[model samples]
Target: MVVGSDGFWRLLYPIHHAETIRQAAEKNNLDPLLIASIIRVESKFRAENVSKVGAVGLMQLMPETADWIAKESDIPYRGTVDLSDPETNIHMGSWYITSLIKQFKGNRAAAIAAYNAGPGRVSRWINEGVWDGTFETSEKIPVGETRHYIQRVFFSYEKYQQLYPNF
Candidate 1:
């Protein structure tokens, strides 16, 4: 298959947090590649990236979500700036993703789509029953930006799988 361009994943991921995220994902029995993909999709791998929607840091964690993650993971975090650290964000973010997996019954694709769009929206789609799992696999995502993001993360997942198949 003649691949297109390298894709929208050119931004630099923090080398420091790579190890941390790997460890956290391993501990959670989650795929570090998927976590990496989430970071890429969530914040384009910037440690201090902040979204206009009030999501902050590498994981693009919203304030409420960050607090929930902190509580659920029992991680010590004070202000929102702590999330600006790539390591902390990835730590919590990967755990949160794993939690969502449990919530969604290992449906990583649906959980990812919900993370990008929102549980309610995804739930609506799911209840509509017109969407099979393929609808969650990037190409069929409803929202335009989320559609691109889902595709990008899956592409990143493919790259990470090739790079670290054992993980």
Candidate 2:
């Protein structure tokens, strides 16, 4: 298949909150492209986006999850955190993904899957031999949404790399 021009792809996969993404990723020792990919797949860079399940902001993080992340990551929180803020959401999301990567032993597929399906479920799948937590075996993951979510993040990540090589 012939891919679209870089300009066209850039138009479709625009990166918003670059500085915030960079800061969050760097602080968490993560690739900014990965964060951008997650944001694209999660909320398409829309800060006000909210999922049907109460996930909010560009990263579509749930309030409870954000609160947990803040506590774990030592981010400032006093019960009411505005997840709609790009900086806060990206930082928390980055930290959470970084933790997930560590929890899954750097298995990005599993980490990304856990980001969508929750760590407990992913761990259960791994422990039960339901899935091996590798990108190659992502198809074996029981949750279709998580499998598709990983695929989308990967696609967006590649496009971001291609369009913004220097980023």
Candidate 3:
């Protein structure tokens, strides 16, 4: 799926839940495209998809993480099964991403890395200078999975902007 209008549509079709994504982005003070990119990369807008590691829904949030976010944000507690709901998942995931962006001091690459790996590991890497928390230095990230995840998300993010220039 490269090089044509078909590829563009394939890449962006997952963002059909634009209303939910925009609502979550507005509530969290985030760019809707960023949330869309994350959803595209994480679950491809497949609400029923679950990662082998147990992330769920359009945003691919883990149950434990969703629980913590609910408690911390004072959102009502729903069972993990609700993570398969696109609305709930997007809201939770947007809040989590907003928090990560703040935790990483607005370094989006580091926040994306944290989303793939974990905030604690990303923090340690930053604090210890193991990685500089920039896309240019992404190769310095030790975890191969996280490294590629960051790259893929950013690549899709750029495409989302290009395809939807007015978005």
Candidate 4:
């Protein structure tokens, strides 16, 4: 879905439980605003939104990743369509993001990139030590799309904080 500059909902998106998203993020020690912002950037909060690449739902989870998360988290195996549910999506996604953060030693940019680009890309960045302000280590961020994804999410993080000051 195409989101405008303002980031308002032009069409109804299925973010039914802001509190659930918040709780999952907090439980994982992630900034709730950051999670919310990523959802905004990733899928424009459109649950059931599928990417051309087959990432599904509000967080646009890939099928393999969704299966992995479900198995790892002991969440019941639902078909990919259940990803549209804010509560389930955020629960699994928040856990997965927390996993990435640990793997990257709390590097927000690296974890975020991994979330977008995949673990292999983030690992290369870690090894090469090439990075930008948007990245702490940039050696292996070869994919331009992942780079831009990181930038957009970081920008959205700030805006999310402003939109909901308490979050």
What are the lDDT scores of the predictions, listed in order?
A: 0.74, 0.89, 0.88, 0.76
Identify the runs in model 3 with alpha carbons over 4 angstroms from their true place.
1-3, 6-13
Better of 3 and 4 by lDDT: 3
Give, for candidate 4, the lowest lDDT window spanning 10 residues: 5-14
By the lDDT metric, which is better: model 1 or model 4?
4
Compose the digit string of candidate 4's lDDT tens values, residues 54-126.
9887788888998999877866657787787777888778888888888888778888899998977668765
Q: Regarding lDDT, does 1 or 3 come out ahead?
A: 3
Return the top candidate by TM-score.
Answer: 2
Better of 2 and 3 by lDDT: 2
Error of 4 at 157 (Å): 0.5
Tell me the deviation in Å of residue 19 in model 3.
Answer: 0.2
* Candidate 2, 47-159: lDDT as tens digits: 99988999998888888998888778876655434788788888889999999999989899999999999999999999999998888888898989998999899888988
RMSD of 1: 4.0
lDDT of 3 at 53: 87
User: TM-scores across all candidates?
Assistant: 0.83, 0.94, 0.92, 0.82
TM-score of 1: 0.83
